[model samples]
Target: MAKIAYILLCHKGPEAIIGQAEMLTAAGDYIAIHFDGRAKPEDFQQIKAALADNPNVTFARKRIKCGWGEWSLVQATLLAVEAAVQAFPRATHFYMLSGDCAAIKSARYAHDFLDAEDVDYIESFDYFDSDWIKTGMKEERLIYRHFFNERKHKWLFDTSFHLQQRFGLKRDIPHDIQVQIGSQWWCLRRRTVEWILDFTRKRRDVMRFFRTTWIPDETFFQTVVRHLVPDSEIRTRTLTFLMFTEYGMPQTFYNDHYDLLLGQDFLFARKISPEAIELKQRLGALYSNDKAEFKISNEGTSLFKFLTGRGRIGRRFASRFWETESTLGRQRELMIVICKKWHVAKRLLEQIRQVTNVPAIEYLFNEEHTDLPDLGGIQTSLGKRTRHRRALMRMLFDYYETDQMIVCMDPSALDLLQDFASDRSTTRMLEVQCVFSDEYLIGHAMRVGLAGEQTSAETLERLLPTIRGDMTFESDKIRDAEFEHHYIINEARDAEENAAPLSNFLDISHDKARQIAQSDHLFAD
Candidate 1:
């Protein structure tokens, strides 16, 4: 089986691209580059020449105009996949890589790992509820579909609803899809790629809808993958082998900690300055500068190209999401603890502290109940007032206000939430719930509407489900005790004065947290 590395690019890096080509050379993988037509002529030409030594490099003829939520990137990827297949007819697997990405493993090892897994990597799952197809289109496609043609977006709407009802999806659909998949790029066996291509060609409706949606890159891949192979035995995420530039890298939660760990693991320190000739080398990584020879395992006999279920001939493969839900729920619980106990809310806060500047201690408790203690010499409330509820009720509104709020209910769910927000509102919300992870507390919080904060007539509708989801028939004692505790907290004149019910002051989840987060309003006056 042959392995091909598909790298997608737009205008930014030339040296980074060259460095990646060298890494692909080391991995003995064929390289296909798709420039988005936005790159400077000099940089584009330089990249073309750098890979001139490798007979495997294939550049696409169609240069898409790159942008987020648009189909340009996705189309570019499809073009690259098409070219790689034609140029390297013997290639068995196609790995989608970004120009700034560096392979994490040697070519030989990556190939062997795919061989051993005996599965193809692709995203194939439904993301919304059935009713979502109707009026839901506006909400689901709310983010980025500007590049899509109006006529083409219809299919995305249709496909989304179909996937939900027909594909056995759980209730509630979250805002972001990438977080749901864990990784944006993946390795796909030739068979799977071919299947996707064939399905796209065959399903006129799917193709048509993909043509005009917002964020078609994400919607297209997800919808089609789910429709065609709902039960494929594929590992949802592979290690991100490519290194990304500062701009290209996806935002991270524990970025500082992760960067330190990843740098050590890869033997690199920081991102290379613009003056550097190569990325890994510029970053002080062990890298090669000479012209390199590239070779991939032959299409039919190599270890990397081995297909999963060698003898099976069906497309009904279940996705990895089902098995991952519980694990993700538990993991989010830990992150909540970290945020509350460790005093690190986000990468920015961590970095500022690392750089020797003192951030106000209140930012650490930004996620906690707004009624909590003072920081240093000041007492403040950063929450905003809503028409129906107080600041206490505003933060949970995303989940509580709308019945449509998607519960990721998976490890990546929290990640998805984080990606949707600019800062760490989602993390704080998760931590707030972490206190309620216990059956008694969960039931207690739900029943008392988080200690009478759910009392507003406008908020009562939203609190009902939480009450039902947590409380069961057998636990009257815990229920009664919780009720009494909530009564004491709310009834005491100090309840509003010292209404901070969150056990962990660091894990705050007051209303208006999202509003505060949006305005970067961490420090209260």
Candidate 2:
């Protein structure tokens, strides 16, 4: 068995962090935690005392005053990494995590997964090569120096930075070093961690250069690690899931995020708050039960990996439209439109009907008089919209009795749905939509058709061409859109108003109901 070390960077959520530590603890496995220096002494002491009895747990002797998008964040992480390395000399791999993160898999599973790999699990992309430069800080993050966390002479720093930018005076990136950026969380092998420490020691100038850069934590380790390893040795994916808002705020996970969390291939998920006590308890119980039943077997391991599209094999296993009682009137309107655009509607119906091997395909409508054209294998039920939706979902959960249910209405998500169906290693409930484009015609259709929003006939006409194009269900575009949509939905649901609906309808939360309501339709005239 290989020893694993976890370096947890924490400021809050002490109980959750402690739970995480306890879950990952085993003989030869160790944990090192560094509480933010800004945190109260009592808070740190409380977390420390909780793990005092555990011999495998240790705390960093040096804690940096960490702040978001500051050098301190990287400093604190390095401190924890160094402490863990010193404390657990035999550790084969180190997993970097946050205070809010929880392990979704068992320690044995994680160990087996890593033991089968000779590569580092770190998400890295060249700074200039990725969309990060376009979507992220761009020149502001790299060209000018930032003193964002500096309290003293803050005005002076801002003035100086502005003057530098105004005069085209910029800090020169090291000529020999290629800059890379990625998600800050990573799982690195022992040699890689040691190399990073040694690299920093010998390259003090590099360290000093990044000190003034924005969010250096996301880039520093990535640039260093990629530079040291061969391309084949690097796997550009983190084994953790982090949800960020459009404004770049980290999302707090709630009970509703449970299904999505379990569906992902990641070993851990982050930003879980203390308020999610129920979720925390559920996760604890889940990992405990999984760990108990876990046994390393060779049957179908390779095939399972191929089917799921994940690098490591673990255990071999195993939504609502509309709100309103005037659904009949709404259905009449939709039917008239469907009749008008019969070609597109026919294609969509055929595409859905052709989808085979699914346990059952059911459509629930609130209107008793809905005369929707019947498609084979799709069961339709009529009742009050919300009531029908809830009952149907419950029935589907009971009938399938497994996690591999893919519930989607749009034909655009067909490719993604097929992917889910092929992967039997895990159970997932997939809700397909044009999550990439808020202005996508299908999104507008969903808003008006599903959410009961009012729209003009002219808008519907303009949306026809786009809907026809979307019916093809371009796999690449759908995948990208789904990723972006998940990001926004995760963020929005963290807010109070959105939280309620998110809890009630977990899959619908990703559509960002409020944002969709307010968004301008491109086809609207």
Candidate 3:
């Protein structure tokens, strides 16, 4: 049987740590804990009282104060690893985790699983090639020396990082080892742990260089294992399931996510919420009867794409509309069409372009994009060109009304209505709605967002060349005259008779339509 040594490096949540320790020990696993050096005395005492009598658990010597993206975290992890090795000499697999990590599978299953495997599990990707790190400094992380903890002294950290780059101050790596990066969570064979620790001790100069390296905990052991271990021996993946958001924060597991945790092949999951008392208890009781087959449905990649696409909108050009630095921004008369249906919106866009004569921009502010170009060809303002681009934006849409009242059509940025509602310039807004989308109406199933999906099913007649082409149409007549607020209910689709009366439907649907326009919210004050 493979005896697993679970090395837990934790900062906060001592009670959660106690639960994990008890759970691991009950599962016939060895435990080593490194409570953050800066942990509260009372919290530390509670942990000690809970696990002090347990034979399977051992405390790491010289518990270091862990800081985000600093050397202390690596030190804490190493301390726990050493303690585990000394306390549990029979352990074959050494699994790394944090205080919040808990066993989602039975110990017998994990033991049998690893006992059969000859490979070590760790994420080892080339640092230079992989686009893993989301928010912070990437290549710059190694190129410059980070002195201050980024969380505590963000300004100083950023300033020093840039200043070093500005002055061309560069540091040399000890052995010029190709820096491989990965998640800190790893499930390694005892030999790998030994090799990593020995390498850490032997390469004091490497350790010295890593002391000032950003997020050394994520890089140090990963880079070392890749260098020492053969490719065939390493699995290049972790048994532990942990997810970091694009914002670079660990997504916390809660009681509701119990089924989600159970469904995965991961033995353990990191960063369980301290408040998830029921979740912790449920995870502690997870003991499988048979050795489960190791087919994992890791929702890591799928969930990350969703989370990143939704959260990191600033990185995309479509989401950007406002500029902080504005000079001489006089109010301008602008007409904006707020519509979700692209076919209907495109038709309106054509009419506006005809009325204005200089390309009524399609989806200038809409986050989502289809095959059609998203940026509106003129919305982007990268780096130094931002000034002139912003000037052009102001000239085109904001500074003053053009001779023919040039329109700026956007499908997603509904907030723009609220922004310009109270402006001195007479702003006209047409909240267009297609009865075809009555099934996916506002405030319900439909949300026009940065999903990059174009929801349009215009009929063959509507998509005809005559209607779609550059011919002057009836819709163009609407733009010829000035209108403050118009609700163009596009009755394009076939309306079917339902249980509800026509009068009842009209009353309820139009009321919702008015709300969708959100004109009242803008002009309420």
Question: Which one wins on lDDT?
Answer: 3
Best by TM-score: 3
Residue-level lDDT tens digits of model 2 in 16-83: 67777887774347899998885557778888899999988999889787655689889888888889
> What digit string (tens of lDDT, one per residue) describes model 1 on residues 1-525?
446556555455687677666666565667788876744567789988888888868887677756444667678888887778778777787776654344423454455556766576654334444232332244445332233332223345456645654765433222223212223566677777788888767766555555655556555665555444445466554445323211122212122232332332221122222322333443223233223222422232121112322313332342221121121211121122122212223322332222221112223223333222222112233332111111122122211211111111122223323333322122232221122234444445555457454345556557556555533321332223332111111112231322244222223333322222222322211
Task: After superposing candidate 1 on the true structure, give the runs of residues whose Cα lies further than 4 Å from its correct spot.
Answer: 123-125, 129-139, 142-183, 230-232, 241-279, 282-525
Model 3 superposed RMSD (Cα)? 20.1
Clashes of each: 26, 3, 0
TM-score per candidate, chains pooled: 0.43, 0.54, 0.57
Off by over 4 Å in 2: 26-28, 133-136, 150-157, 245-251, 290-525
Q: What is the alpha-carbon lDDT for the whole of candidate 1? A: 0.42
Candidate 3 lDDT, tens digit per residue, 1-525?
888888888755676678778877887788898887765667888998988899999989886866667898888888889888888889888888876577787777788778887988989899988987654468877868999876445458778988998899998766668898998888888998998888987988888888899989789888988889899999888888777543233555778887777767688887676557898776666653344434467675575566556534656433323342232133334455655455555554443332222225455444333212112344343332233434344444322212113234443343445444444454556655443322333212234241223434453333334332322233444444434444343343222321122113222343333333332222111
Error of 3 at 294 (Å): 8.7
Candidates 1 and 2 compared: the better one by lDDT is 2
RMSD of each: 18.8, 17.7, 20.1
